[model samples]
Target: MKKFMNFGVLALLGMALTFGMTSCSDDDPDYSNVTPPTVELAKANISGMVTTIGGKPIAGAEVTAKLGSTTLSATTNADGEYTLEGLAENGTYTMTATASGKQSVTGSVTVNKGETAAWNTRLSNEATTVSVSQTEETSVEVVTETLENNEEARVTTVTVIPAAAVEEGEEIIVTPVYSTDYATTKAATTKDFMLMGINISCSNPNAVLKAPIKLTFDLTDDVIAQIKPMKEVNGSWVEAEVTEEGEKVVFTVDAFTTYSLFINATLNQNASTEAISFAQAEYDNLYGASEMSVGTATYTYKMGSEIGQHSNLLGAYLAEILAQQMAGSTVKTVNGSYEINVTLPIGTALTLSGKQAVETTSIAAGSTTVSGKSYGKVSVTANTYNRQHNGGTN
Candidate 1:
């Protein structure tokens, strides 16, 4: 038996949202003496249709919506439609669609007031389309160059480090089954609506082995500001340490599991922000200055403004640039372990070494918590558990 860590993407949207729209008339109202209304930021809903190049709905396609900095993702239903919540109704947004064998498509949409927008997108399998094949050559040397940002006094870099390949005659199998069942039990509502997950799988199963994969990133000053390296689990980012050799960030695994990158960022601001924890909604409210919003974070005036969540995001996987890195990902095998090295932002480097594993009964059925250790939220489906295997046989 062997122990191998799994890597995967978990697009989560636990927060529910509701929005509505009202059309204004051409008539103008006199407000020379009327006081302006206050603004309260709130979450909005975004949804759309997805189809194949042949006009067929694309079920299970990965769909992600990004506004300014924050991003949310979900899978399409049987109707080839997806709905992403926990988004602020304060700005314009873009959505990306990805499927197993189709060319991915990206489009923009808007969410206003309490009103959600409807967008339609299509994926193609045409010759011009690029397939996201998991297996690509992984051996190449790397060199890097840096770029600078004047506003933030920061520098960006694009590094090209190629990982070694597996020895000849090794069987290659790639499975997408990856998970770790860790959930929040303290509160269902505050169950941490932030983060994404990825399941790592390979040709060998249930064995004590390591899967090595690398990411090639075009680092920018803004991206490095909010970067975190870890696996999201039970309301936590399980840190996995990576070394920065030149332009690459490297990781080594020894068991089946899910992985993530947690980015903590703020929304784009128009006016200078106050110490106040709210966004400045740029329009007028349905009511005068005295009108207050309840059970909602949004004021009618806050529609179409600058705003975002006040927490770290578990959402890098939804970005096209992130996916592009994997397109060039490579891995090599030695004995029973895989070697993976990638060029990406080192954000806040982390590690899983010396961390204690939870010894529990069966995994808590679904996304639920037990005692202080949550399970089922992050899961790995593998042939062998690392605790039982001895890191593959000689």
Candidate 2:
């Protein structure tokens, strides 16, 4: 009976041990904590009316939203409705709407989790107009009379010229006249401002100071006041004072005043008439007397006041002339690339020596046919200048 009791006790202990082991195994690593990435989802339903002050319905506008760096673009339907999909995490976004030849419309919208946001955009006046008015202001005009060596010079009485009507922020090209006898081919010089100053754009790369003698272009009053007692040295004019006042500067200049200018020119005994002879002589040897019709070629071209047309035409003319002068060369291709990553400038050709694919090329540049004789092939490559595509291949 004692042996039977020992067996029972051992059996009970084994059962308890087995239950403990099963509980430990059940507590193994649980993957329920490893959740999948939360995909943010949203949509945009935007609607708005665009009309002029006269209440004309403007159609076919484009609406866009910029959230952080990501952007969503959509175009308006004929009814002026736009819908966008696949928006990311909720955030505030800058919304903009635009149409051709119309002012752009803008607004903002805040999106929430799984929420569809509504936005409305309206556009206003989009045209730019300029008006010109002139104030009664003193003007200065200088005329050169004669010069007597470096010792004495006879300058005509300075006069006042009427201020012309100019639009605000417009550039006025002022040409200062100098006596024909004034020194030419000088080392460097400076000219002082005596009248008519205009403001300059600081960040404007187009704002520039240049000269024939001492002409001022787009001079502002603030610039003149700051640079008063202006002096010229080492070929450039330097302002004598600081006129910048806080963020705004005032430009003003005295009228009928004379500014001193120092020039570093070698006094040549030859006059301008003699200079023409030199021009004729140079051209005479190059193309003979026939090409020496060296008087001003007064052809009407697009340029500034001198040409009275578009200035871009001047550069186009030079490029065309250069191409025409090339001999025995037909532009096979203007731009060529071998590797997929390679690129070349327009009007440039790359010759592939070996193991390169052969591609046919074509041209569409505006060219005049002179009796089937091409002075030079004007190959206009795509994505280049204003000239039409002169050459290409499919």
Candidate 3:
């Protein structure tokens, strides 16, 4: 048996997804008018089958293939088979197969170019109970009831939620985020993305369940700005209204199926901060300015100005590097308030050389959080890269 779907959407629960980006560089000369390079890659083809834990094919089950910013879906045919093509090539992808009146099953998949990856999983009814035990430290052990034969089936540990029928305000699921990690600033909202949706089921399979359970997630305010809870149909996201209750984001999920949040990830926003100015100080040292032109960020900056440095946010750090690293010739900053339009590809580790100058600062110092992580500030004198940071190459 494969592992069940896990949302990892407990908001600031601290279970941050780790990023892995890779790139190459040279001596890299510093020159004005440096145009950072950009790369665009595509995924490959994939096929799969869907069935119930009882060994029956599920026709018309909605299957969605997601990787990076690309999402596509197709319905299973009468034979309970489906295929998703042109997915992100040579990277990790996730597939969710769901059907009406049945609990959805999600699984992880890896696809490489020219390789047709296959995904197969068993979906269980929301009310079915399967005994569970722990196998490996990272794996769950499950024992299922008899299938067509009287033989019981042993399965692996999967993410399971205990069953409960609610009269209305009890917490059905308590998703956690790293609450201790707070951000004074955020990645300039680059491109808005709908974080993937996931399915949750009761811990015990035999327990009866109902919808309208209150769901709460602990996330930071800036991240909350990028995403909202929603239901996934076919491959599109349908917005569902959610309420902000103090430190928690609360909403109602009607079924034991899949619920996804549309994360905005608004990198560059139209706003102002009290602590930062274009050039904070004169001794700040002179590094030529740079700009990331990805989306519609309508900000402006002056060359050779005392720009804010030793920043906390990666976007800010990225901007600082671009400014001084000869990525762009002219320096630029947001004139007043606007959005940023620079694009970074998904599914790769953005490895940058900090020379160990990356430090985490206190929340009061206008620190920014990247996936619940804090890096104090790179010294204005240190932290230089060899390349133009061409949006990170693969």
Candidate 4:
């Protein structure tokens, strides 16, 4: 009887323990049906300041950042500070800032995950000037002023308009678009050879002009000779007829949009010795010092120096020597330094014996040749050569 009671007690204890464990498990929370905690994703941001070209803070300026279809925007505070939040991380955004009475600026910035990228922009005051005219034919001189004190800086004149460009008794506004203000236009039209650029537009864009309008640009004759007038048409540049009017360049255009003076790179030159000499002097002046070597002797000179004054004579003598070599002739010179009057095509061989020699031959125009083994070759363009060498140490 004792053994039976012990076995029954052990069986009852085991069953109670299993039942308690089952109950506890059923009462516990159902984690499979409950929702899990959510985690926030990381994002990037862009911050910047907006100011005027003069460095003055621009309050209330609009700053925008765009990446594909997503666009974020912010406004500048009194301190010119702006913050664009919640941008896609590790992306490049095109940023643009704008303010009233100021030029808009655009740039690009990159942001990293959970970080703000800094961008800064400076807006320029509108450098364009507008004038109203009510005459049949009128002239407008557009002038740019210095930024510091608003003093007159550069002036470009537009003149000689027919009645068609502007209707009589109708007020028309003419605006001058400066390159500094319109950099894109300048870059597209001028490349690296721009001397001066002027943009002209009438209030009536559809006005049909019967005659061409004239423009006068402030430039020297030398500069005018090396450049040509170009007009912007449909976003492309086309050559316009240009003329030299005193120290200014005058060009006529049927339509007035943006006209510029660009150095003509393909311009052929029939340069005279005087012109070449002047150019050489100008180059020397710009670069401090320059030298020319002939026959193992080097001549060093600067602008306005004594040696510089003899550029024409030296150039002519060099040309004569080269011409003789090209024509299968020998050039003989004495040991002492002397001057010789050099005229082009001086009959093949030149014999210089410390005395002036005059010789003439027939050679092709605009032909430059170099031939010789004992003496290095010389290249010269002979158009009209008359060089006289007096007693000088050059």
Residues 189-222 of candidate 2: C-alpha lDDT, one tens digit per residue: 3222122122112122343322111223222332
The runs of at least 3 residues in candidate 2 whose Cα sits more than 4 Å from the true structure, single-residue gaps closed, are 1-49, 53-56, 131-394
CA lDDT, every model vs. true structure: 0.34, 0.31, 0.38, 0.45
Error of 4 at 92 (Å): 4.7
User: Top model by lDDT, which number?
Assistant: 4
Q: What tens digits encode model 3's per-residue C-alpha lDDT throughout 324-390? A: 1111111122221112223322211122111111112111112442211111111111111223433
Identify the superior model by lDDT, candidate 1 or candidate 4: 4
lDDT by residue (69-138, candidate 1, tens digit) is 7888999877676667656545778878889876576667666543344445555442211122335533
Per-candidate total of colliding backbone pairs: 50, 22, 49, 2
The candidate 1 region of ten consecutive residues with least summed lDDT is 373-382
- Candidate 1: C-alpha RMSD to true structure equals 30.7
lDDT of 2 at 280: 14
Candidate numbers sorted by lDDT from highest down? 4, 3, 1, 2
Which ranges of candidate 1 are over 4 A from the true structure?
1-48, 51-198, 210-218, 232-236, 266-394
Q: What are the runs in model 4 whose C-alpha is more than 4 Å off?
A: 1-60, 76-86, 89-94, 103-135, 145-164, 167-196, 219-229, 261-394
Judge candidate 1 against the unseen true structure and give its global Cα lDDT, from 0 to 1.
0.34
